[model samples]
Target: MAERLHDPWLVAVWPGMGTVAMGAGYYLMAKLGMHLWEELPARDLFEVDHVDVKDGLIQTAPLPRSRLFLWKDPNEKHDLIVFIGEAQPPAKSAQICHQLIDLVRPLGVTRVFTFAAMATGLRPGEHGRVFGAAIDRGTLDRFRDLDLTVLEGGQINGLNGVLLGVAAESGMQGGCLLGEMPQLFSQLPYPKASLAVLEFFATLAGIKIDLTELESHAQDVEDKLETFLSRIEQAIHQVEGAGESAIPALDADEEDEKKKPKLSAEDRQHLEQLFTEAKADRARAYFLKQELDRLKVFRDFEDRFLDLFKK
Candidate 1:
């Protein structure tokens, strides 16, 4: 026998800064806002107790090898699937998702969702627009009010594209909530966007996300990111400008400048410290670098993600 698996119909999340906000929000609600967010504290609404994460690739198709969590509604038997993993897409993440779906849905999982974000030119001051797309039109119509500027945004590359396609194939209900964080949000946390996504998810799940911790973290992440972007912008200006083709046109002359990262001891230590924060998601961290190495544009912005969770 397959040992009679558990936690089907779970609410899955991937490990990233977004997951941090989602998990933090869930934690705050379960711990302090229980009176308002859920009818049951531990088992019904937030099921962190059910998380199972592996060290390596858990899925190989279109999804990340997600660490799984099962959120159940106490008053009712209804549940949501949460997978927390460092996501890539349509390569390994899909496989992990399919495995999870096969294991859980037979038990009664009717819907699934994955939390992620997109790097955009939009800044936090711009209401942190939350974009959502569903596996089906019905789901799209459902989230029309959350303020998505790009109904076509989900068409972009990576896990966002594949997961939705898989959801459609599996005959399961699925949706993705993508928050617009400034392009600089990559390689660092972005709290404003994270909070916006959580609030949007809470509305869908019919629960309120406790935003106290998220608000605090958002302030910190925002400050650091603000500084980082200023530097990047300044660097851009000193060299040229932040235009599409203005990055000094990395030609032969620039090729020589592309050596190892030049850093002071303090900067090296800080980089190491950043890696430590992602200890649970080493694969993602490694792959991110590899992808960065392969990127043609600014050595690729895709891998510079500020992923902060086991996702």
Candidate 2:
């Protein structure tokens, strides 16, 4: 990547916990119509080349691309540059960070924002809070003024987390916006968390985005999740009620014959844990939905009230 972008504020979003942050970043790219400006060449970062075998032939699919995109917000003085990646660098991610900083420096990138998910064990259906961490006071103050929660002591692992520190080393202002989500959803693609992140980013970056698509997606997820949770709860109840009756008895002759092992106390304990986690996941989802509803109502009233002043 050359010094193609000049004086642009940059945001780097990588796949991470819940896939929330990456989804939000990609959503912004689509909504803002960002154009691919330069390439970082995934070849330099990822060690393994991913390939697919289709039918009888082996197809070497294109390597994962890590690229920079540009979106000139006509309304703003500074331009926006976004770095989107399909895969994180396998090794020496620190070197990758430095390379990114070098690429953006000539572009006059003084600030970098990264998106991430925070597993705070917060209950579901509750409003997923946005947390902020920054390298400089100015950027930290901006977060404070935005009323974003400041993240306390904790290490944010991975490229999405480390990029901020690297940018700060180069005298660039750096910050990360994190959305709260259940720990169990770490491996899940959490649209709700992504939506929360985007909501915060909209306010923090002063970018006006119509979140209708994300909102719809979030609603659909919640709908399906509600049904799933209900079924899980029912199953848990049945399992608990059945007790020992749920397990098939071993023949007494099994003392001398080989027999299948029955569900042990440990197995029951594990099942109980799963049931508990399922309930918690459902609760968190419910609270998040409630939070969205409140926001929707508020936005509706705000729009109508503003319309009253329109000519």
Candidate 3:
């Protein structure tokens, strides 16, 4: 028998450009402390085309696995189901989506979401803008309200786009969130793009999860990329005998800081109480983590927050 879930929203992800989709999916799974719910049989859909060899001996490899992780909402608003696939099959993507829908529909999933990457001519230091594409008008309106760049006419290409198309055919409400990344670095892991997608998704789903770790990682990548770009620009300038570098600096508006959430005295007290409870019972740590995330102070208490799980 399938486990009963409350108003669950399904978010599916697979390996793609910039690793945006998979990064967000894994982060959600870790922060929410979701457990493995089920494994979708993949042998029919995914066939191994190559094998590894050790000491000139061919070794058989297992087909890629597709898994589902469940996070029951503490607020009873909506449970979350994150589907992570080890690899996208070379063919029959639509059929795999059909199988996925059939599996989740019975568990009361009405809305589906997929994360993807949009390769653009963006600078490495620039913030990645999230693009939105919906299966329905109502969801489109929500995207507009969020000020997301609506994908007017383009192909989303791959399972990230195909799954939403399948969901629409099955009368499901869903959309795809595409994070903008540099076309030149499309093959690189862009955690900034992943962070941008997750920030929007967290708002859309009304779920709170600590994103400080992701944010820090994104910042580190941004700094490294900036340095790399600067060196390349300097080399180009020397080659061209130019008086000034051709690369433009990032706009001041782009560097503006986002306003942090303010916490009340009551909220502070509540946080302390939650921390105490979490210390006694490790299972309560997720709830405390959520509160800390909501207040945007997860970094301040990160060490202590992680201490809850110390055995």
Candidate 4:
């Protein structure tokens, strides 16, 4: 029989855009001193192509394996079971999810939460908005009350998204908190975005976490990025002005026209507030449009299983 837990909550974190969601989960595990409890055997779930070279001798080795960590705080109201995946299941993922559910059933885990990121084309100054989605209205309302943006109609894809479908099979409730990442930073880990999600997670799970370390790391990255952009802009100007005879007064007027007004702290906050409201309005319209097309259906007979979570 599987081991029993004290009313545990299962939280699954996986890699996605920006790697922000999964990185935040890892940070939490380390900060909270969570212990390794079990592992999902990777013999069939992932490919074994990695090789180890030691002293000119070649040897094949298994790749990184997915694991589950446990944090049991007897003084707290709930225990946490975190599933950190090194690689997503290669085939028969639905079956894998079902097996996971069965394994945790004995632990009295009926609530599941997943972490992910949403790519919005906003700049860095507009970072830190977190969005949520759930299969039930009660969960959605809970997030709304916390002032988190609740996605009304868009679909969530990948392993994080599929867990919700699995949860519905047993009448359990599940929610996903997706931090907003700018499209420009989609290729890198956005710690600021992750910080926002972690803050909301702490609130939702009734846990306390010190985010001082992550905050410092995020600030450092932002400073380096700004310096890099300034260099690139300078290079562009040099190239554009090459082999040109410039008239001084004309150049000054052109520079003045190119400059844009910089918003103050208060003004930036106001602009972000307005942007959030506008986004919500558009989401409402999208929700209504989806309702009208409820009867319209399309089919794709592709054999790509990974595509299921990409929807």
TM-score to native of every candidate shown: 0.55, 0.72, 0.77, 0.71
Give candidate 2 regions above 4 Å deviation: 1-7, 49-51, 241-311
Q: Candidates 1 and 3: which is better by TM-score?
A: 3
Q: Write the per-residue lDDT of candidate 3 for residues 2-61, one digit (tens) a residue.
A: 557889999999999987898788777767767677778878798778897878999986
In the range 1-311, model 1's lDDT, one tens digit per residue, is 23233333444454454343344333322222121111111121122323333576353222122344334455443444444344333245466546656666566666666556777776544557877777776667778754454357436345545555676788888577777777744544455776777777667666544466556656765665555456666778776535655432332312433454545677547555645643544323433332233332322232233333212
**Top-down TM-score ranking:** 3, 2, 4, 1
Which number leads on lDDT? 3
Best by TM-score: 3
Model 4, residue 100: what's the lDDT?
75
Query: Which 10 consecutive positions of candidate 1 have the poorest summed lDDT?
Result: 33-42
Q: What does candidate 2's lDDT look like per residue over 266-307, in tens digits?
A: 754754454344244422222332332333331223222212
Tens digits of per-residue lDDT for model 4 on 86-144? 65665657766777777787778888888899889766655568999986778888898
lDDT of model 4 at position 85: 78
**Residue 106's lDDT in candidate 3:** 91
The lDDT of model 1 is 0.50
lDDT of 4: 0.67
Model 3: how far residue 271 lies from native, Å: 31
CA RMSD, predictions in order = 12.2, 15.4, 10.9, 17.4
